[model samples]
Target: MDDGCNQVNPSAALIDLRPVTVLDSITELQTADRHKVAVTGSHGGLASGRHALAHGVAAVIFNDAGVGLNGAGTRSLADLDRWGVPAAVVSHLSARIGDGRDTMRSGVVSACNGTAQALGVRPGHSCLAAVAALRTSAAHAQETDTAGFASASGQVGPHHVVILDSASLIGPDAAGSVAVTGSHGGLPGRRAARALKHPARFAAFNDAGVGKDQAGIARLEVLDSQGVPAVTVRHDSAEIGDGSSTLRSGVVSYANSLAIRSGARAGASLIEVIRRLPE
Candidate 1:
């Protein structure tokens, strides 16, 4: 395997030859990084993979996200192989789920497509190792602002609805408001309180295909412990980076105890669920 497992020495030569881009989210993908290693903190789901492909990244590494719900997480590996893109995923347990730097710093490869394997990238190697091994692969790039979303706020009856492209957009002002975000409902680093820094009246996230151990919906239970109402939209029903799509097209896939008590239920439209929230 040309995985460069033998290259334990951090050579300034190798790093300068093929500088890879590390992104906290694939949403931060830039046009300059095309045809270079793109290591992202995003889930290894097909949606995320497709996003990278659209930008023409050389190779991508993502978190496996517990390989949830029929393997929707990391499903892109197989597809990337078909598309001839070298793709691999790190174990969910290796680092924080949505933080790209963490993924590269400590993430361990859990799987890689045949294309990556053919290039000597494989499971058990560190993400950085995988990055170095595949640096020579043809990379590609695209562009988006670092903020990642055009956030807005409005009212729904007595409740204020804050539509954000990413959960990271939730501000202190949303403490008593409602948040509809395009981010997935996973407990990054398993931090419960970090689910929503603000005590929003209610919140919603994408289900990321409800991957392993139901990790995609893990945020709901964790949010419950914070005494907050939360729900997740089904991944297929909405685009993951468009908060407007989350509201208009998302279907409630799961609800926390507080959400259920507040009239939220699975298999309901998010609009219907929001309408049912108590004043």
Candidate 2:
């Protein structure tokens, strides 16, 4: 037997794989992390699929939201397939939806696109195992001049609508604007009420699969306590990180007391309800 070249435990080779990026939200993707394998806390939707493509990541992972409407939550798989990008999502039940470390630490694969399946990724695989496959994958990153997504601002009736890619972008100056963010409607770490930097006239967030224990919509009640009208659009109904898309097409999935009182009912267009919210 030559020097320990033939290690029996093949897993050792995968233990120290470098160049992977873990993000609580895909919007946090930076230039440094591009072309690397990305594991994020964002949901796998059509818009999110585009965001990942725009960043030119080699591979990506996202969270699968609950009770998808017309397959909105896991629609990214098919979208990625068209671009020859490998993609997959962890089960919302196995990990908190908006926490990336938790997703990588505890998530189990829930779905995969054809490209991922070709690489041996499968349902029930742990997040690490999936990343390992992507690490050694023969897949190449596709580059395009596609402009990266950015926050968009517009108006709805008399409300100044601020559509943000992440709720974390909310700030003191945003106090009176109606905020439509792509951040999950869940509280950060399921405890920290951090989405709002300052009080807004109203806010909307993505209901991240309404995952286990309804962790997805956890922020609604908290916002209501502060007298802020808040609502969550279903993960399936809109992109998880495209604020413009969320505002343009999001349908309400959950609403807090104040929103409900304001006629923010589930299945109604978020823009429609916002028109009636007091300025």
Q: Which stretches of candidate 1 lie over 4 Å from their true place?
A: 1-38, 44-60, 63-130, 137-147
Taken over the whole model, the C-alpha lDDT of each candidate is: 0.77, 0.79
Q: Specify the highest-TM-score model's number.
A: 2
Q: Compared with the true structure, what per-residue lDDT tens digits does model 1 show for residues 70-119? A: 57567789977776788999987776666677788888999999888876
TM-score on alpha carbons, each prediction: 0.64, 0.78
CA lDDT of 38 in candidate 2? 92
Total clashing pairs for each candidate:
14, 2
- Cα misplacement distance, residue 2 of candidate 1 (Å): 10
TM-score computed on alpha carbons, candidate 1: 0.64
